[model samples]
Target: MLTINCPWCGPRDETEFGFGGEAHRTRPADPSALSDAEWAEFLFMRTNPKGLHRERWVHSHGCRRWFNVERHTVTNEITRVYQMGSASEAAETAPAAEQAPATAAIEKQGSRS
Candidate 1:
């Protein structure tokens, strides 16, 4: 099982959390202006990239707070964890050397598997 580091509650078993889907999606400025296809795309479309992916997650069994996670899809390695609304585009594109300490810990865990 994976150990997820909750920004509010520290590291916890993955079972304590709930997946909240892809993050950083902006709501349309005027929903009424959207055609049916556009509205459906907004609601259902998500990127299924093979490498790094940003996602939302909630600590359901602990603090019940929401956070964002940057994870590697194929390896299941969580590279970063940040509170909701605090992530910046620059941080998202930062180099590995500048990655958070939590990322190192998660990488270590991934290596064990």
Candidate 2:
């Protein structure tokens, strides 16, 4: 079974999470200014890269919070995991799973208030 590290919930079985599609897909600021083709492209176009892919995921059975995941498609190896608004570049280089001060521990500490 593949282990996915959730930003808030820590490492867990893949079954506990929900796979959301590609990440960083920003919505157009001026929707009314876009042509039909441009709108359609934004709505439907997605890169089906065979190598490393960045995506969104939700810890459905755990924290129930959404986060980002960088995974290799062919090997199904998760390279990194981070929260939605975290530094994507940093997460891509160093996965939260391997970081010393994990966000899950921080979150746990915060909840004691």
Candidate 3:
């Protein structure tokens, strides 16, 4: 049983979260520009780093926000977690899973009251 620590919602069962592959990786803006191999690489290849790897995780049950997480691949231990930001953030830097869009939406709703 894998458990993930959601920065906003605390630690929860792994079933509540979705593994989003490597963090800081984005789909090509123009798929047409990519060659067959490049497209395949994007879709299939991934760097399963042994240590201090960044990954994306979605909190399906709690905040419903897609965020990033820092984990150890070999040991299956999570070191850090934060929220995924805008598209640009995904490109430049993969922020942790504390500030996802869903949480932002929830925060907005709370502010309205």
Candidate 4:
């Protein structure tokens, strides 16, 4: 019974959204260079934290936009959500990426329209 607050569709049941693995996970620049052990670690290893965690999530049943989410696993509370752009956009907006959290971005984007 998890209620996910979609940036576009308001809060909805968790069933409507799909879970993405750990966020901010950058792929190796040269995949072919990595050994089997390294590749396996990248594919299977993850930080299953007890508190706040940043992860990617998609609104499957609503807007269908992929966004970053900060969730608390213990209480199932959503702390923040923001549109996680592609690599180029992320690199270009590094300053904004540092200045505000996802919640602020969501609000600002909402107000502009």
Estimate the TM-score for candidate 3. 0.67
Ordering by TM-score: 2, 1, 4, 3
Candidate 3, residues 1-113, lDDT tens digits: the string is: 77776656767899998877887767899999999999999989988766888778898988787767777878888766655665565444334433443233221111211
RMSD of each: 7.7, 8.3, 8.8, 7.0
Total clashes in model 4, counting residue pairs 3 or more apart in sequence or in different chains: 0
Give TM per candidate. 0.74, 0.75, 0.67, 0.72
What overall lDDT, based on C-alpha atoms, would model 2 receive against the true structure?
0.74
Best by TM-score: 2
Q: How far does residue 99 in candidate 1 sit from its true spot (Å)?
A: 19
Estimate, for each residue in 39-107, the C-alpha lDDT of model 2 and write its tens digit.
Answer: 999999999899988888898998797877878999999877756654454455345445644554222
Clashing pairs in 2: none
- For all candidates in order, the CA lDDT equals 0.74, 0.74, 0.68, 0.72
lDDT of 4 by residue, 1-113 (tens): 87777755667789999999888777888989999999988888899999988888898987787777888989878877756765566556556545543334353222222
lDDT of 1 by residue, 10-30 (tens): 789999999999988889999
